[model samples]
Target chain A: MSYRSIKLIKYPTQEFTPDVFDITTQAIPTPKEGEFLAKLSHLSLDPAMRGWMSPDTESYIPPVTLGDVMRASGIGEVVESKNENFPVGTRVMGLMGLTEYAISSGQGINPIPKELPAEAILSVVALPGVTAYQGLFEVLKPEAGQTIAITAAAGSVGSLVGQMAKNLGLTVVGVAGSQEKCQWLTEELGFDQALNYKDADFAEQLKSVTPNGIDLFFENTGGAAQAPIFERMNAHGRIAVCGLIADYQTDSPAPGPSWLNIIKKRLTIQGFTMPDHIHRFPEYAQALGGMLAKGKLKYRSHVIKGLESATTGLDLLFEGKNTGKLIVEL
Target chain B: MSYRSIKLIKYPTQEFTPDVFDITTQAIPTPKEGEFLAKLSHLSLDPAMRGWMSPDTESYIPPVTLGDVMRASGIGEVVESKNENFPVGTRVMGLMGLTEYAISSGQGINPIPKELPAEAILSVVALPGVTAYQGLFEVLKPEAGQTIAITAAAGSVGSLVGQMAKNLGLTVVGVAGSQEKCQWLTEELGFDQALNYKDADFAEQLKSVTPNGIDLFFENTGGAAQAPIFERMNAHGRIAVCGLIADYQTDSPAPGPSWLNIIKKRLTIQGFTMPDHIHRFPEYAQALGGMLAKGKLKYRSHVIKGLESATTGLDLLFEGKNTGKLIVEL
Candidate 1:
């Protein structure tokens, strides 16, 4: 069978667009000895992909080079296998890329549990859920009654962060781009309050919702939206720096919070990557899986059909168009 | 006896010049029952004074109100005493203000040991030394052989930070304004290397000295000086945010290091005040005092005579004119 794949043809100098990718067809080769071939189903489109597309600089990982298939996490069905671990007809999830088929040496691929939904493996069980669990519990250690304010509340990580914080007895206030997203956070996710950052009175709304000032701020958006929330942080507040989705498209990093307030308030801010939290995956999977099974956890995926739609589908994340985990079904 | 006192007549709007202070004469008042009087000797001048001078804001302590005596830490000889715990002729250290005499109810005063030099009480045994010790070991937590780059490396706190980190077996790089200050850091204080931030090739100089990348950054001077060192920080670096002396003179808080680098490097940045670390004072004093006694630690004081010099003496710190702790000898 032939498969369609997207390869990065050029390094984006300004902003990332579909023009950087070259869509082409190639023959799907059979798995060699000690290798397995998986038919890719759902490809995860994330904010960190912009960082991966950038030219090499000081980073946790090297930038994805040109002429390579766009790196992504995905779920697939093992159609052909020579490896004993991943037999034929087994479902798995790993760095399957934005492609129709993947041949792996079984280094990173993990078999998904039959009881869990296939999409949940990509959304909650795999990357976003693991990230939310670690960042909330380890990085931003909020007390039981402390208030937590998270940005990108309608997104995969933020939604989970809100629900988990609430489950742990902490008050949660979510900040999102639209009223619909805000309503979903407050009404469905049980967030104490949700503020639309696009609203004229966002700063005031943020203050009204978090009357005692925010004890923990889960910073996903890093720009103008961050400035006001930073100003309202309580003394000795903790900030878990997860993503800077706002500055990904910009040439340089956007200006951060006022250092004066940071000094005056004695705030502790830490930036973390999810890869470092892999050791806690079993711990997270057991907890997050139990929550999901008990109906205490809820997740949503904004799915787009076809491999050709990968380019435009990613832009939806940058524009905050997707309401949850952005996925491209190939 | 008549004594001259510096009082804040008006709140400083922008840059702090001599005009905000009113140097006036007042008779040395007698101490009431349960109160003791001390003849103020040496007073500490700090960059944090600028923050204290600001109108009411969120802070660890309340802003120094107008019409109040300019608040400062000072060494004094107890001339009159009603409180038996503090006998007359006892040399004490406390918030004695910018005055020739201080009347205290023994709230904040601490008696200084005769074995310790009076200047040492104000420099290493007091605020600056305690700040450096805690920020280096407790907050930053740099392991031996790790590279540490500090801003304001010639100032009271920075000078001590460089020395302490070196004593702990960490490689030290100091950042100062002039070549002389940089020389003092590397030669006198035993810093591994010192970079003059004012040099034309400061960025290159920083990169050359911190060949393996900075593991701990003792951030003292904020603004332009900090931006370059931040880029040179290694992954999983720690920043002990001690002071933003560079931003004190400005109307607004200066922008800090790039949030991108913070996320990319997974930096742990924390702002700390000495008051918060007061409980650790006993621990710091024992360790730092031992180092000072064994001739392992040395300190300097830039003493200006009279309360009249308080205004210009403070400017020296802002301009990086002082080689060490800026003190006023009354």
Candidate 2:
């Protein structure tokens, strides 16, 4: 039998185009000693994928080399196995790429629990949950009664972050692209306030909502909302820069606010990525699973059909079209 | 007897001109119970004074109230005292203002050693020295072999920071505005490399000097050199934002570099001011005094004569005309 996989043929100039990837069919190979062959059930399309496709090698993780199967994280069930740890019918997850079948030597793959649905595993117990947990707790170090402002509030990572902060008794203010996303943050996730960045008087609205000024800022989208929130930061405020989704598609990203405020407010801004803390994944996953079981965390998946839809589906994240976690199902 | 004093009659529009001050003669008042009288000797004119004169009350310290004595730090001798800790003939230093005499209740005053010259006290063991110590050891937390790039490298605080870092076995690069200042950094202060920001190929020079990429950045001036130095930071770099002297005088400060690099490099940028760390002054002062005694620290004073020169001498700092620590000698 043959399997289909998408390969990145060319690096993008400014933004990703459909021509950058090529789909091909190859014969399914058997697993070697200590290896397993698994059929991917779901693929995750994340914002970090843009950095992986770029030519910049200085990023937290090395970019996916040209003409290689595009890098992605996914869930799959072991169909054939030579390794004792990962037997047939075991559900596993890791950086398994955007393909129907993957042969793993059991290096980075982890066997997941069987009871959880594929969407729950990919959304909560995977990259988004771990990233949110690390950025909010470790980087920002939120304290109860402290106010926190998070951008891209409707995105998978941001949604988890706002919920966690809210659970900890923080005054959470969320910034998103649309009114619907704003509503979801305030109505469903229990965020204190949600502001749409597209509004004409967004800065004034932000001022009105955050009367005491922001204390912690979880920056995911670096765009129009950044300056207003930064201006309102109190003394000794901390900022955790997790992503710059707004600038990913453009060659010329906008300049940041003046450093004068940095000195005036005595602020601390730190940038982080999940790859640097990969060893803590299992610990974070366990904590996240408990939260999910306790009904303290809520997650949604924007599922697309088939592996072939993965290439075009990524733009939904960049364009802010996807309502929640962008997932491709085979 | 009457004493000459300078008062802040008006706040500047964008830059400090001579017209902002009002020279006045006041009767040297007697000390009340528990108060001591201070006869000022040498006054220190620092870049932080600009923030004190501005209308921004959100700064690290409150702005100097209009029509009040202009705030400044100076060394003085106690001529009369009702307080036992600071008796007559005691040498003390604190925020004594722009005057020849001051009255103190010993709230912020500290007694200094009589053997040290006023220049050494103002240049190394006072505000400049403690600031450098806190920013280097407490904020940046430098390791032995790491590379550090400091802006305003020839200034009092920057000079002390470079010498201390060099003594700790770190490769130090200094950025200055003039060739003389650059030479002073490399030749006199023993900086590993000193680049004049005015050089047309300053960025190229910086890149060639810091081939290993900057691991620690002591940001003092946020001007032309900031973007280039920021771009060269290595992964997990730490930046201590101490001052932005370049932007202090201007109504429109330049926008900082894009924060995209902050994520790609996982950089940490923190802003700090001495007022926030007042309680640690004694500990830092003792450490700095030891460094000076061991010949591990060197400092210079650009002394201007008379109390009236204090108004214009401050301009030397903003205009980059002052060669060392700007001081006014009575």
**Which candidate has the highest lDDT of all?**
2
Per model, the share of native interface contacts recovered reads 0.87, 0.84
Give Cα distance to truth, residue B161, candidate 2, Å.
Answer: 0.5
DockQ in order: 0.81, 0.90
Task: Summarize candidate 1's per-residue lDDT along B1-330 as a digit string, tens digits.
Answer: 788888988878878887999988989899999999899888899988887888856787888788889999998988898999899988888787888888999887888787887778778988888899989888999789999999999888998899888988999999998889888888888999998888888999888877899899999988667888888889999998988888888777677666888889999999999888777787888888888988887888888888899977888888888978988887
Number of backbone clashes in candidate 1: 0
Report how closely model 2 matches the true complex, as a DockQ value. 0.90
DockQ category of candidate 1 = high
Off by over 4 Å in 2: none
Q: What is the DockQ of candidate 1?
A: 0.81
- Local distance difference test, per candidate? 0.87, 0.94
TM-score of each candidate structure, all chains considered together: 0.97, 0.99
The sequence of per-residue lDDT tens digits that candidate 2 reaches over residues A1-330 is 999999999989898887889999999999999999999999999999999988997888898988888999999999999999999999999999999999999888999998998888888999999999999989999999999999998999999999999999999999999999999999999999999999999999999999999999999999998999999999999999999999999999999999999999999999999989999999999999999999999999999999889989988999999999999999
